[model samples]
Target chain A: MAKGRELKGRIKSVENTRKITRTMEMVAASKMKRATDRVAAARPYALALGDVLARLVRPDIAERFPLLRQPATTTRVALVLLTANRGLCGAFNTNLIREARARIAELEAKGATVELHVVGKKGIGFFKYLGRNLASERIDITDRPSAADAASLIDGLTDRFAKGDLDAVYVTYAKFKSALSTPPSTEQVVPVVPPATQGTPRDFLLSPNADVIVEALLPAYVRNMVYRALVETVAGEQSARRTAMKNATDNASDMLTLLKRTYNSARQAQITQEIAEIVGGASALQG
Target chain B: MAGALQVSVISPEQVLYEGTATSVTAPAFDGELGILPLHAPLMTLLGTGTLRVESSEGLKRFHVAGGFLQVVDDTVRVVTEEASLVG
Candidate 1:
């Protein structure tokens, strides 16, 4: 009876755990849908911006724009690590942290001073535990990221790059390829790599002139890039969470089935033992 | 059909409009620039102002902040970050 009761308790707890995980899985799935939609919606603007920039930006003009200026030597660099605020997602935060660590190591190996900027609570906690210094840490950003959020995040870095204060800037995040695949990756946002000019150049009318327009356009392009990374990371996080929760729920169900069967068998064994004891007492008294 | 221009107004968040329009007036950096059908290819930075899109149905207006406008082969693409419908 004691064994049966214990198994019953375990079964109840596992059922509760399964319920929670099931709820989480559904929530994550819905959020993933919306996040993926956002990633798709943001694409047209990026493509059109790239198209215009490709036509306007050339080798000579690129030299004039400070944001597009390539530093002759690698000395100082900024690594912006993007992670999720919460840690329920499996390996999402861990992968990003690992990628960032590797990136920092690579930069340090090249004799560059890396100024680490981390976003999300998970990343901040991990770096703090490691006793590493963070140039900046922000917990305000959430799954619902906006263009203003992106601008606020990257504008200062872009300004420093333009001022020649920083040699280069890199952002590490999970790139959402599909619901099944989101790989951790790093991209250099500074020294804007101009997209290869498509087709032949056309003599297009430029308002005021090319220099003024390019100056204004380059920062917008950078902002778009940051926004894209933010949205993609959110999508990846939700997808990872959904998969993790699904697996957890499945495991809980299997455990519950096994525990229930054990509990039933234990209860039946106790009943048989009681019947046998009563029958033996009657037979002994009769004899 | 020959006179109408294929227009796409895209923001960072979503595509606000994608259809044929008679003309598009965007807030260029220096000043307001208007695009009619068959306008020469042009690229210009946008300023914060009202963007007007005239079509057969009516005139659609948007409050656009920073971005650019591109015109090529009768396709007017208005790409801006801060854009919302204006009443």
Candidate 2:
């Protein structure tokens, strides 16, 4: 049985914890809203670029551009991994690392060489422990990153591809599914996938011939794809944090409730014991 | 036919501009390069400077630094290192 003083002290401690969790929850919610908006705003560029890319990848342009050509061998691949700069959210980094491990194992089983361009401290830590060879690395890109950053990485990747250093390039990150669920997703960001051509791509008249247009469009395709992925990654981070903070707040509340019950029962038991002692003394005096 | 090219100026945060332009001028690595409708299929490294595009309204200028320009058919995709508009 806890004394009133002890119960009050315990409640105060729980209250302090609750306040901290509540504050975190609010911060996470604000970040989630901003991240979601950024992701949505970036989508048009991604889709429009894809449309232009689809038009560029005609049978004719495929003949001219090495990037457009389908590879005869699936021997080696490079993955640029983006993850959280920090780790407070639940299972966000875990899911991505798990996905990457499985992917690397699969590639190894197929006798395909796998290289990595690790972005964020999470990826750096994960691969460093595994002693994996990294193609390139950048850490701590959690906040908003400009298109210029994307270009620097893109230049590195494209140069390697141009020199035939890597056969394919992929980007791995957590895709923002919703507030409660962010799924780890991997997409090919390099050797840009030509958009699917269903409509009559030839219907639109080109200022230049289609060949020139195709030539001009490939890099734009890459930038948009990378930018979209980053936006989704940021959104996913916010969602994960919001979800984690909410759970924390809920857990703290439950703990407070349980503590309160224990405290009250303890309080009642002491009162009853004290009353019994006093009444028993009165009865004894009368006897 | 030659004057119209699909030029999209985009930033990571938003699609800054997307429309039909009669002519487009970009900051190419070597110098400023202009594209008319029937310009050659070209892949050029971008430089920091003014990105000029002609539309129905008049000439639109974007202050840009570094990127790449890819021209295919009627589409000109300007991937700028950094871009801001000039009034």
Interface RMSD value for candidate 1, one decimal?
0.9
Candidate 1 overall Cα lDDT vs. reference? 0.92
lDDT tens readout by residue for model 2, B6-87 = 8888755676778999999887766878888987666556678899999987999998875456677878877653678888
Q: Taking chain A by itself, what TM-score does each prediction score?
A: 0.96, 0.92
In the predicted model 1, the residue pairs found to clash are none
DockQ metric, candidate 1: 0.84
CAPRI-style docking class of model 2 based on DockQ: acceptable
TM-score of every model versus the real structure: 0.96, 0.81
- For candidate 1, write residues A1-287 as lDDT tens digits: 77887888899899999999999999999999999999999999999989888988889877888999999997999999999999889999999999999999999999999999999999999999999999999999988889999999999999999999999999999999999899999999998998888877788888778888788889999999999999999999999999999999999999988898888888889999999999999999999
* Each model's fraction of native contacts: 0.81, 0.31
Q: What is the interface RMSD of candidate 2, in Å?
A: 6.1
The deviation in Å at residue B22 for candidate 1 is: 1.3
Q: Encode model 2's per-residue lDDT on A120-201: one tens digit a residue.
A: 8887898899888887888746577666667676767766775677778888888877767779988887676787865554
Stretches > 4 Å off in candidate 2 = A1-10, A202-209, B1-9, B17-61, B64-82
